[model samples]
Target: MIQSLRLATALLSGLVFGVGLALSGMLDPARVRGFLDVTGAWDPTLAFVLAGAVTASGLGTALARRLRRPVLANSFDWPTRSRIDFALILGAGLFGVGWGLSGFCPGPAVAALSGRSLPVAVFVVAMLAGMAAHGAARRVLLVR
Candidate 1:
């Protein structure tokens, strides 16, 4: 019962996020492209969206930290990487390129499945393939 409730809450939160993204014009490819093309025709609207997201996420994390026990887990699994390395930089560059080309990040891509976008479907498949390949490569490298 508790597990089902947790899953329902998570799904509901994701649905709300997807609706917000769609309503806020973030789901439009042109808006993302405009934000990236800051040299010719700079559009700073996405900056406000990013700022608001960061603020809300920061506050939410703070609140979660104050809780004695997490509702769905033993504890939070926060990343310990404080310093950016070559792998991190390279991965980020690749992700940015993919985002610019497809205009559909992971969460939005899944959310867009209901919107009948063929290209989003392709992007999601390719993204999953890349992730699978990365995992395999990591396993191989770690064994050697």
Candidate 2:
């Protein structure tokens, strides 16, 4: 069925992404931290990863624009917002700070969890808590 196919595709995509992260040393906090340390013992490996990600993203976007709809969906779901707002700025700032401090963004952190690392588990728990708190705060603000 189409639903099963979609699930399989999603699983495969996630597997590939996780494998890529592992291979790129993105799952290693030390490597990521080294990359962020621009002034001392800088590692440039992550820069190559970032460049590859950007290139893939650019190619994907271009391909999406040429298609009428996604291969497995009814239509393409793209961002509707164009304006830069306070919420966007705040969210980005928080994300950057978190990444710089922990060297683990959401995707890489989740992928790193497979190694059963205590620190990674703690980071994931904190990340989930932050997401829940953000959702709750957003709901409260919207209710006013």
Candidate 3:
């Protein structure tokens, strides 16, 4: 029952997120590319979108910390990573390159997949391959 509830909540959250992305023009690669084009016609509209997201996320996180236990889960699962490592830097750099080149990060990319564009499909495939490679590499490299 708990797992079912969690799954339902996850699906609902994804639906909400996809709707927000579509409404905010985040699902449009042209809008994202224009935002990144600071040297050219840089569109700062998405900056407001990003700021709103940060603000809402910050407030949500603050409220979550005040709770004794998660409303659905037994406890909060906060991120445990404390140290910045080489993998973190490399991954971030790669993500920026991919975003700048394709104008689609993971969330927006997945949302944009509904359009059925060949480029978007290829990007999603490449993104999944990178994620798989990262996990495999981490296991091999971290295990000594």
Candidate 4:
């Protein structure tokens, strides 16, 4: 019963997220590039998308902390890491560079794939490969 509820919630959340990405023009790589262009024809549409996401996340976080346990999980299981570490900073820098160059972050890239775009497909494939490589490297390198 609990597993079913969790699955249902996951599906619903993914659907809503995909709809939001599509409706907010986040799935468009050209729009994303425009936003990143800054001095040249910068688009501010993504700012509204960020604002909406932050607002929703803030409210959801506040409500979640008030709960003793998650509705679909045994516990909150939030990340333990809070400090700004070297790995975190390096990873973020890499992510930002990749997002800027490709005009597609993980979520937007995945959502955009629904349109059957060849570039998006290639991006997703490369992203998945990178993820797999990272996992393998972590297993061999990281002690924690």
Candidate 5:
């Protein structure tokens, strides 16, 4: 019963996220591009969306940490790192560059693909290949 409830919650969360992306114009590459442009006709709407997400995620994580046990899992799975290191900074810079160039981050890229955009399809394929390479490299490094 707990697992079922968790599954339902996950599904609902995804649906809500998708709807929010759509409603916020995040599903549109043009809007994303406009925000990244930062010229005379710059759009800052995405910043507002990101601010809300960060605020909610921050609060939820803090609340979850105080819980005795995770609702569905036997234990909580949390990252130990509180410090930002070189790798983290570099990875974030690369991710931002990719988002700026493609005008579609992971979530929005997937959402855009559902609308049948060729550019999004190509971007998603390249993104998947990059993720696969990263996983392969991580596995090899961990084996040693």
Candidate 6:
């Protein structure tokens, strides 16, 4: 029963997220690229979307703090890391580079897959490969 509820919640949340992305023009690589172009013809749509996201996140965090546990989960799965490290910085840098170059962050890229775009498909494939490579490298490093 709980598992079904969790699955339903996840599906609903993803649908909401994908719809929001599509409506906000986030699924468009050109729009995203325009937003990233600070010195060129910049678009402020991404900023508005980001502001909305940040506000939602802040509200959710506040509500979570007031609750004993998540509504659909046993407990909160908060990040265990508190301090920034070299690996964190490197990962962030890599993520930024990929986003800037492709204009398709993970969420939007995945959502864009519904459009059946070849470029989006390529981006998703590359993103998955990068993730797999990172996992493999991490395992190797940990084993060293």
Among the numbered candidates, top lDDT falls to 2
Between the candidate structures 2 and 6, which one is better when assessed by lDDT?
2
lDDT for model 4 comes to 0.92
Of candidates 5 and 1, the better by lDDT: 5
TM-score per candidate, in order?
A: 0.91, 0.98, 0.95, 0.95, 0.87, 0.98
Clashing pairs in model 3? Answer: none
Query: What are the per-residue Cα lDDT tens digits for candidate 3 across 1-144?
Result: 999999999999999999999999998888999999999999999999999999999999999999999989889999999889987898889989889899999999999999989999999999999999989998998999
Q: Where does model 2 exceed 4 Å of error?
A: none
- Write down the lDDT that model 6 would get: 0.95
Output the worst ten-in-a-row residue range by lDDT, candidate 3. Answer: 86-95
Report per-prediction Cα RMSD to one decimal.
1.5, 0.7, 1.1, 1.4, 1.9, 0.7
lDDT tens readout by residue for model 6, 61-130: 9999899999888899988889999999999999999998999999999999999999999999999999
Q: Looking at model 5, which ten-residue stretch has the lowest summed lDDT?
A: 108-117
Which tens-of-lDDT digit does each residue in 65-113 have in candidate 5? Answer: 8999887789987888899998799889989999988788999888777
Q: What's model 3's TM-score?
A: 0.95
lDDT of each: 0.86, 0.96, 0.94, 0.92, 0.88, 0.95
Task: Indicate whether candidate 2 or candidate 5 has the larger lDDT.
Answer: 2
Looking at candidate 1, the ten consecutive residues that score lowest on lDDT are: 22-31
Which prediction has more favorable TM-score, 1 or 5? 1
lDDT of 4 by residue, 67-90 (tens): 999877889988898999999999
| Number of the candidate with higher TM-score, 5 or 6 | 6
Candidate 2 residue-wise lDDT, 1-144, digit = tens: 889999999999999999999999999989999999999999999999999999999999999999999888999999999999999999999998899899999999999999999999999999999999999999999999
Q: Sort the predicted structures by lDDT, highest score first.
A: 2, 6, 3, 4, 5, 1
